[model samples]
Target: MQHLSILPILLPLFSGALLLLPPFSKTLKRQRLLAVLSMLLQVVIGFALVASVQFDGVTQYILGDWRPPYGIVLVADPMSSVMVCVTNFLAFGALCYATGYHDRTGGYFYPLFMFQVMGINGAFLTGDVFNLFVFFEVLLIASYALLIHGGGKHKTQATTHYVILNLAGSSVFLFGLGILYGTLGTLNIADMAQKVGDLEGSVAILAKIGALLLMVVFGMKAALLPLHFWLPKTYSSASAPVAAIFAVMTKVGIYSILRIHGVVFGDDAGELANVAQSWLWPLALLTVVIGTIGALASPTLKLLTANLVVLSAGTLMVCAALGNEAATSAALYYMVHSTLVAGGMFLLADMIARQRGKAEDRFVVAKTMDNPIFLGILFAIAAIAVIGMPPFSGFLGKVMILQAAHSTAEQLWVWPILLLSSLGALIALSRAGTTLFWRHSSSKQASDEKQTIHLGEWLGIVLLLGASPLLALFGGPISELTIDAAVFLHDPSLSVDALLTSPLADGGF
Candidate 1:
């Protein structure tokens, strides 16, 4: 169990490193097989970790006999466990999709993909804030390589902008961490939370400033308003499988916000408690408004899905800004709902582009696909789920969020923006669906040049789209898990205490 906690990060790191070595590195098929088997093993480990955390309460593993507030530790609770599970699940599905669709592979694609997952897993599992920064860079660097994988003009352009912007965000992140460590003399997340609670006056003010700066860094990563310009072009230009995996990347920032604010700056956080609310709430609403508008205005299917990605982030951030257990819980549920739906939508867009020839997902009157009905059904599922239609997880998630917001005075503002945002998403999706399926679709449509859909691509999209209804079906248990995760975050003493006091582990938890 102790090893399991570290394996999520180390497994991918070592696997990626070994794949780049001779013999294995020369064979793309061998590399792909290794990546798949490794990720599947990770999924199993992630599930067992989640189970262990639930049974044993919070479990901490001190690295190399070092303890918390002094040495490195990896703590697993409901939140990190579920997050790791979701990330590995996405990586597996996307890898399957990549293997089937990509005409060329090899290169650093397989290795970088593994490192990307490792970075995401590390960010989720680490108990130290500084390690979070390390993981963020790991993921971002791999993403930079992945972004330009195919080597095109547009991709190169997107990669340059993305690299520059994230470099700036990284600098801000380090500066904020420096301020925090200088103020509290520690980088361990658990210790920072406790020390943050002990501050007063000038020290509290410094800590708040540091927290706010860190929030700004996370905001850029999450694609929040004013910082979201990089997402549309970057996501739209990336390869389908890459874009699909990137779906969870934004949610990474959301998870950080929930974990940091809910634990480090909770109600007992003195003056810093809710300090971000005054600015965070309005920014979230504006992001929703802008993202909706961008979706409505997009002329291409990939671009539209890209905009919806931002919309999902902003919508979830509304709950984060609310800063309550119920709200955070609902936000987590919505996060899961949105990630799958958006990933499906991105892959679907790629398929449409592949089949549509010159029109290439332009939302204009293009040729109908070979399996129009099959493709159309997939698109409908995505649109319906994303737009929050009934009997699906999206609707349930949205309703839960609205109800949670009702408990706050900001409900007046939260309700309208969310409702209007939903309406905006609906209108945009309806127009796109009509343009793609209704007006352009033809009975006489046929294409000798149409590319046949592969089994692997179908399975990938199906797994993602299929999850929405299943989430709706299992809504009770999933929601309960989110609520439990939120409760642990709200009183993080349960998460932090074990880190400080747990005995050294030889092998297992």
Candidate 2:
């Protein structure tokens, strides 16, 4: 039962590796069949892991039987479990979509796709700080490869920018990790939390510095305010399915901020307690304000969605900065909602662009889409969810976040910005939708001339868009679970205890 935590990581890792073998890699059809079955299993295992945590509080698996403060641990509290489950669902949907959309026999798409999922799962499950850095590299490499799977000038250029920026972030990450290890004398996250408050004077000050550096590293990844320039290009140039899957990547930065800030350098960490703490709420507001403006000003559908992703990241960071039980719960809910909606929009934008021919998804009067009814329906769903309208998880998440932040010192600023951003998003999306769908050139191509969106493509978009309501339908239980997760996080000692106490069933490999 404890070992369920490792299955998410292992399933994708082994599956991707096996698929890379000649016997499997030679046949794309077989690979696709295996990938779908593998992902379905992953989704089940992920939910099981989430269930285990809610029932058991914390579930950790130690590698090589080395135990906490020494061994690598994979811990699943409700938060990580939720992320794992959502990631698996998103990957499966996106993978299924990609199958019919892309050339099944072309390049290393399936293998790299699985590896990308593996990296994401590893990031969510690893309990050691250094290993977190390792997983980031793993995911980044896979993304770099996948970004250019079928090359284009824009894609190649965007991939280069994305790679360079991330590599620099990786370097910053390593430098901070070194200082962190030197200050706390440990790399295990729970151990660091256990040890940080015990340090005094110089070591404690250095620890704070390390925490700040790590914050900057994660900040870049999350596209927080001043650090967000790389996003528009990266998303605008990527293929539809690739951009959709990348939606969860930003959440990694949010999760890292929450984990590292809420646990290791938490309120109990002596002088390090408030490290990078002051910036969360204010930066989130600024990010949203800037991002909303950017989205409004964006000239293309791809760019608009990219800007919206930045806006969503800022929204989640508000909770990270609040660092309270309610705020954390709200943040988790918002993460899931934003990821699904944003992913669906990316794919929809891609399909729209393909249908628009040379005009692409530019916010201009262009030819009508091949399937305007299907596209309009899905696009409207995504847009409504993005703007945080009623009857969707976005509305629920915002309500929870707003309610959670009402008493915080930052509320005076937070409330208005969120409200204003939503309004702005509504206006921007309305205009874009009208321009793309309602107003069109008279020289319309025949129905036969439009691009045929494959079943896999529609299924992928539908699954992602459909999840918003599913979240709303299941809101009660999920919220309660997030509150539990938040309580566990608020008291990092629970995580530490769980890591220390988690029994090793396999002994040593």
Candidate 3:
């Protein structure tokens, strides 16, 4: 059981290293096979971990066999478990999609992709603040490489900007960490949480400053409002799988905020908590407005990228602003839904671009919508999910967030902003859907003989789309899980109680 805790991070790290070995250098087939196997292994491990949480509650593993406040700990609570499962699922799906795209890029794609997974898993599992920074850098570095994997002038330009901006953010992150270490005398999050309330005067002030600075650094990564200029261009320029993978990157930032705010600075005396609620609300609202406007104005697939980034920021901001159990759970739900929906859409965009055989005119009719019923249906479902239609996972998640927002004094602004943002997303998506699927073209539709989707691609799409319905069926349990997770975030003592008393069961009392 203890060994299971480290498997999530170690599996990918080992697989990634093996991919770089001499024997694997020439065999793309073997490399891909290994990548898929490694990813599936991780997914299975993630599910087992989540199930463990459901049974025994939150699980913590200390590195180097040392006790808390002294040694680094990796927590496998509901929140981290949820993120790990989602990240692994998407990693597998993206890898499947990349099977078709791999030949277009060189053999290096799989290695970098695996390393990215390593980073994401590490970020989700690490219990130390400084290790969080380390894993984030790991993911960002891999992403920078993957974004420009195609090596075109446009991709190069976008990657350069993306790399530089993120590098600056990374520097800010480290500086903040330094300040935090100096003030708290410990980098362990659990220790910081326990000690943060006792610090006074100058030390407390430095801690608050450090927290705010970390927020800025993460805000850039989350692409919140004014800090989001780099997202659209960079994502638009990258290949679809790259963009899909990058979708998980924002969640890293959100995870950082949730972990740090909910755990480290959640106490009443923490001045930074107050600042997050007051300042983050206005910033979130602005991001919602600007993101929607950008989507309404843009004519390309890139618009979706911008819109989703804004939506993600708004969702996280809601979590920061509300800082309640229900609100944090809602944010977690939204994070999972948004990442999956955005990833599916990116894959759809890639499929459409591939079918057209040209990137310049993405909507050029390659085959009649009727010919590929599966593709058309999947695309429609994805579009509906992104727009938050009823009976879908997206709708349920949004409702949860709205309900959380209603619990606050700022309900007036929250309701209006959410509605307006939903409206904007609907209009922009409707226009794009019309262009991509409904619009007529002069070219003749491809015959059944000429148009086909790989079995793997179909399977991936079906599995992901099927997840929405599964979420609907298990709404009770999943909601409970998210609520439990949120509760754990709000009060770690409850998590500690569960860990100490329970044997880890399927359902909690």
Clashing pairs in 1: none
Q: Which stretches of candidate 1 lie over 4 Å from their true place?
A: 103-106, 441-448, 502-509
Residue-pair clashes per candidate:
0, 0, 4
Cα-based lDDT at residue 112, candidate 1: 92
Candidate 1 at 478: error in angstroms? 0.9
Tell how far residue 121 is off in model 3, in angstroms: 0.8
Model 1 accuracy (lDDT, Cα): 0.85
| Candidates' C-alpha lDDT | 0.85, 0.86, 0.77
Error of 3 at 31 (Å): 0.7
For model 1, state the Cα shift of residue 167 in Å. 0.5
- The number of the candidate with the highest lDDT is 2
Candidate 3 TM-score versus the reference: 0.93
TM-score of each: 0.96, 0.96, 0.93
lDDT of 2 by residue, 1-509 (tens): 65688889888889989888978889888888888899989989988888877776576677876767787878777889999999998988888788775644348788888899989999998889999999999999999988887887888899999999999999999999999999878899888888888888887888888898899999998999789999878987877778888999999999999988788888888878868878776788889998899899999999999999999998888888877889999999999999988998988898888888778899888877778888898888888889999888889999998988756566887788899999989999998899899988878755537477788888888999999988999999989988887888887557664565435223312
- Model 3 clash number: 4
TM-score rank, highest first? 2, 1, 3
**Lowest summed lDDT window (length 10), candidate 3:** 500-509
Q: How many backbone clashes does candidate 2 have?
A: 0
* Ranked by lDDT, top first: 2, 1, 3
Q: Write the per-residue lDDT of candidate 3 for residues 378-411, one digit (tens) a residue.
A: 7778767766778788788878878887555668
